[model samples]
Target: MFKSFAAKAIVPPALAVTGFVIVCCLLLYSVIKTDMLNDTIRHETNLADTIIKSTRYAMLKDDREMLRNIIGNIGQQKGVEQVRIFNKKGVVAFSAHHAEVNTIVDKKAPGCIACHAGPVAATSMGRMEQARRFIDARGRSIIAITAPVYNEPECFAAPCHVHTAEQKVLGILDIGLSEEPLQRTLATLRMRMTVFCLMILALTVGGVSALLQRNVLMPIRELWEYVSRTRRGETGLKAPVYRDEIGELARSFQEMAAKLKSRDDDREGGSDPPADR
Candidate 1:
């Protein structure tokens, strides 16, 4: 009984379910992971662009206070872990929540020299900002955005400080955000999608199994029983009724059984077999 039940009720459905689930999970995992990676890239890029734009506006207006305020505001934004402002001379002019404000930044920090002082610095020196992930002083993973500040030519005419294009190194802004929050969000989304995909696979396999049993297995079993009864010399055996392929099969079985019965009856009475025979 156990073997039969396993064959009839477990194996086919289980195989179908297992195969479907494996494929669905693999596909869903790939798609979800790609989506999360893309989202992270897009979020980081936008965050860097936002910081650069804000910094540029502040520098254009020559409002140091506004620039400080803008950096602070960005640090408060979701996923923003830190914000640092650097003077043209590579001094840390302002830093939000960082104790090292007013100290000169180490040019050895990742991407600092490449973006602020290296040969590629011209295209990178102004207008655009670069972003990267790094470990902070606390050893926490963080995303940092670096943007350069340029001094306008018009400012050079002022007696206070000459700001020609050649001497226009104004400053750099660095924004950092903890990676934990982004990681958590992506992990949650992956879990949710995996659960959802499994649920869908379960339902699909269950529904298909139920349909196969009702529309195919049950009818075939009934037809087999009718044939067995006829083979046992039982007269007037009735085939099971159905409304699909099973129904047509049952009708054919009934016709064959009836003909055999008629032939047997004729032989018992000593009459010649039917002409077709």
Candidate 2:
């Protein structure tokens, strides 16, 4: 009897709660992961912009030492992997990592180079600056931010300033940042979310199981015991009572048992005598 009550009352609610928790957890994890990835991308892009502005000022002043120092500082910053400066002629003038210094990077490279090289497109090279990402030799995991190094009229004159919008490229600043750190951060968040979701599911299942046992299983078991007693010829068996659906069901069972007992007794006492005798 107890087993029957547990089967009907405990299993369904437990299963329902478990399934709900699992679905909720999966949804939350997906949302958190997407948000984290976007946040990391925005942070890295902002860092690139800051570095570009600082290096631009140094370059305009013709401060090679200061420019090198600034580039080195940017490279040391978290998420920054490498930094390179290109002159208007598409020649690598300075690099944070020594391996790239004096190496000529193709002006036709992806990102800003696609438009910044050859003749300066009016739309591409405005008074403001632009930034983008491209793959380096290592892979397509590098971000390349570029800003044109214009010769300030007060600082550079004549030949250096002669280059106009129609002239050949003057210079570009490129900064490359590693994507590993961002990915790692996102992975950690997903793992944590998974763990938290599991914990919630376990708690929900346990709570549902307990509620079912108390409210449904226990009362049903008591009612079953009453019916069994009456079946074994016990008189005046007391039916289990309650205030909700379980109580109403117990009352109906008690009424049915009384009618069956009455019918059995009438047959045994020969309430209808056989016609032949």
Candidate 3:
């Protein structure tokens, strides 16, 4: 009977604690993961902007070789996957991978649609609207940011280039960076969080179980043993004092047992012949 009672007391609360830990851990993981992803995106966007600024002088001077070299050098960096400049006609004007130069990019692709919302909007695309992300052919996650190469005064005024006041947007500079490193970092963080959560769960269950045993289960087991001894005709049985509802119960049982013993003594005195004085 005590074994059954102990199981009932321990199992339910342990399960509840485990459930609560899992729920809280899941919520925390979601928030951290989202923040990490946004930080990665912001970092990659700044890199793309730097690339555009670095190539601006070459673009103004109409130096195709210099522009190609800049793009190729940056593209070879660790995190950069590819870099290219797409002209107004969706044709690749320059690319780090030279084979891609002169190839026509599909208008429906995310890179093109970023600037080319439609035929009319494509001509007036602002510098603010060029960032997007997608997965590449090799199943690697890619984040692409587009910076518009505007036709500045120096570009139109240069003797090497023809006048182009009407051409607000000269071309689109696209930078593709790999997301594999960020993904790996997030994976490591997730594993650590899971392990930490498991540790917390184990500690909580152990703590709660120990508390219940000391305050509840152990007292109840002692009370059961006292009752068994009393039922076997034992005398002078004393219930342990406690400060809980169980303590009150133990006091009441002790009072009742004392009253029974007193009544039995009274009956023995009455049955005697006036105490034989």
Candidate 4:
């Protein structure tokens, strides 16, 4: 199939273009996916901060019922998978799911191990380090943040507050957001990028093929036809206007034709009988 000039010219470029497109598209998708994931984490972080602020009054009053109700309401919002508050003792103080309340959270759990597994527990953590991704019992992917609720001046100063000022951290607010929405967005982006890649490949390959035919293939085919007609003793052939190597080939053919005609004329003159003197 590739024996023909057109195939030789077009196939290599087509394959090269295809490979280039595939590589570029893959890189683009990877960058977009990473950016989207980081955005989700930032969003979950912001939402966790909001929840802490929302329940601050209840926390100050030591009102467990009000805090639980607040957590339950936040959990009902879209993209929120779970909401729970656990004391420093690893005991669940309140949870959006009431059944989980008063349960002991294992230190080896995914979210807790990062802060508690070491000999010296982490007293503080960076924003990004505080976040984690895990699958729940229902097999749903979740991106959760564990925000530490520290004991501020206002907390210990409250009339209803119980803990002494020695407590650095009172509890932890753990909120998990569903990953389904982020996954859907990535899927859509991948589909659109695939379509775009195909379109670009077609345009690039088609354009290159058209240029080759016009600038290279057509002229060579015309030269071949000219030679064939000359072989049949045809005369008065007009040379094509070409500024490149093909033009030089055409000039050589014209010079060789002129020499052959001159030789033939000389032979005929010599063979003819001399005119009467």
Report model 1's TM-score to 2 decimal places: 0.67
What TM-score, over all chains together, does every model reach?
A: 0.67, 0.67, 0.83, 0.84
Candidate 1 lDDT for residue 252: 89
Rank the models by lDDT, top first. Answer: 4, 3, 1, 2
Full-model lDDT for every candidate: 0.70, 0.67, 0.79, 0.86
lDDT: which is higher, 1 or 3?
A: 3
For candidate 3, lDDT tens digit of each residue in 1-277? Answer: 5367656776777678777877887888888877876776677667767887888888777788998889889878887888899886768998888999999988778777655575565554343455567899988888777776778888888888875888887777888888888789878988987898788777777887788889988999898898888878898978988999988998998887877777778788785322322
Model 4 residue-pair collision total: 0
Candidate 2, position 183, lDDT: 64
Worst 10 residues of 1 by lDDT: 120-129
Question: Could you tell which candidate, 2 or 4, scores higher by lDDT?
Answer: 4
Model 3: residues >4 Å from true position, as ranges? 1-24, 117-119, 122-129, 268-277
TM-score of structure candidate 2: 0.67
Model 4 agreement with the true structure over 82-176: per-residue lDDT tens digits: 99999989899888888988999898989989998888678799888899999999999999999999999999888887877999999999999
Query: Compared to the true structure, candidate 4 yields what TM-score?
Result: 0.84
- The residue pairs that clash in candidate 4, if any, are none
Flag the better candidate by TM-score, 1 or 3.
3
Better of 1 and 4 by TM-score: 4
TM-score winner: 4
